[model samples]
Target: MTEDIKVDKVVDLKGMPCPMPIVKVSKGIKDVEVGQVIEAITTDPGALADFPAWAKTSGNEILKTDQQEGLIKFYIERKA
Candidate 1:
């Protein structure tokens, strides 16, 4: 399901640590228009939990989450 999501923006936060991943995602999401999707690629383990929580609080919609090896990918759609 996540594999089919089309992303308008890609934020590569690989190698970055906690908060920073979400921080970059937060900043990157602003570049995309509402209803557009943003894909954040991060190596931080915490992102698995943080992205969903952040999306919930920020009103963004999380379309998908994929974790492969140590990499985490989040497909987020800006709701506002």
Candidate 2:
């Protein structure tokens, strides 16, 4: 895990499933500035694998991710 960055909002996707977390995080990050971070908290097991791929495909940056207490937290930065 990397150091936590200063993020504008923390999206809690704990109960959400699959692409929902990814979709919500994608939408939420759009309004943020370039280099600004957003923290996504999700319990969706697939996010561990999906998000990083999405970030890469979308040209965003997944700065860090950590699994804690069965939840996954991803710190993502908008590239544009």
Candidate 3:
């Protein structure tokens, strides 16, 4: 189940490809406070796996992930 999170920032990478979405998400996460959440919207299919792996290695927390139509949304909380 996904948590009802309050996102502090939204990084829209909807027409972008693989690495770009991850890159934007990485940068966007820094824009929020340490405990704040950042919502990353991407159309890249690779993001489904990339995000969770990246969040784990980067020490961040992914609160939720939802995929609808062609868009994927990741709610990531900055933990480091």
Candidate 4:
């Protein structure tokens, strides 16, 4: 049930470095409505560590994440 999600924003964070992808995606989705989705595609390994931590601290929801061919896709829902 955690594998599927509907996203409102799709951000391509591929090829970005550790904090950059997280920074940009965090900034990018700040204005999204509550419960709106943000999808991030990243190649940085940091996203795997950073996003879950970010979600926990920021109170957002990590809906889903899928990895294929070294690309990571994360679906997040804004909490407030």
Candidate 5:
């Protein structure tokens, strides 16, 4: 299901660490409308925690997450 998610925007935070990945996603989410999707690609493991936490805190929705070989992709939908 996640593999087929359509993305309105793509934010690449590769090589960034810690909060930066989530930070970029935070800004990227704003580029899309509510119900639209943004795909955030990052190399930080922190995103495993940060993304979900941010989605909950910011009232956005994480439609899907894909992780492989240290790469992570977040499919987020703006809810608010």
Candidate 6:
């Protein structure tokens, strides 16, 4: 679960649309150490697809994801 993941950095993408959400998450990943988890919090529905694509292309691992109400949380571990 996301609650058990130790987050090294958190990026809030609330209200951001499309590419911005993924753009910010891409940048956020760089701020963390490899193997450290970065938590991305977003309200954008597009993040549902963006996050997974990012994890695949970047070779990082998505440790967990939680969604409720309108908020989405992604716990990603840096691999690169």
RMSD of each: 1.0, 1.5, 1.4, 1.8, 1.1, 1.0
| TM-score (C-alpha) between model 5 and the true structure | 0.92
Looking at candidate 3, the ten consecutive residues that score lowest on lDDT are 1-10
Off by over 4 Å in 4: 1-4
Candidate 5 residue-wise lDDT, 30-79, digit = tens: 88889999988998887888889999999999998898898988889999
What TM-score, over all chains together, does every model reach? 0.93, 0.91, 0.93, 0.89, 0.92, 0.93
Clashes of each: 0, 0, 0, 0, 0, 0
Q: How does each model score on lDDT?
A: 0.90, 0.88, 0.89, 0.85, 0.88, 0.88
Between prediction 1 and prediction 3, which has the larger lDDT? Answer: 1
lDDT winner between candidates 3 and 4: 3
The window of 10 residues in a row where model 1 has the poorest summed lDDT is: 1-10
lDDT of 4 by residue, 1-80 (tens): 54457778889988987788878878867968988999889999878899999888888988888888999988889996
Best by the lDDT measure: 1
Compose the digit string of candidate 3's lDDT tens values, residues 1-80: 55568888999999997789988888998898899999899999988889889998999999988989999898889999
After superposition of all CA atoms, the RMSD between model 4 and the true structure is: 1.8
Which residue runs of candidate 2 sit more than 4 Å off their true CA positions?
Answer: 1-4
Candidate 3 stretches greater than 4 Å from native: 1-3
19, model 2: CA deviation in Å? 1.4
Q: Give the 10-residue window scoring lowest on summed lDDT in candidate 6.
A: 1-10
Clashing pairs in 2: none
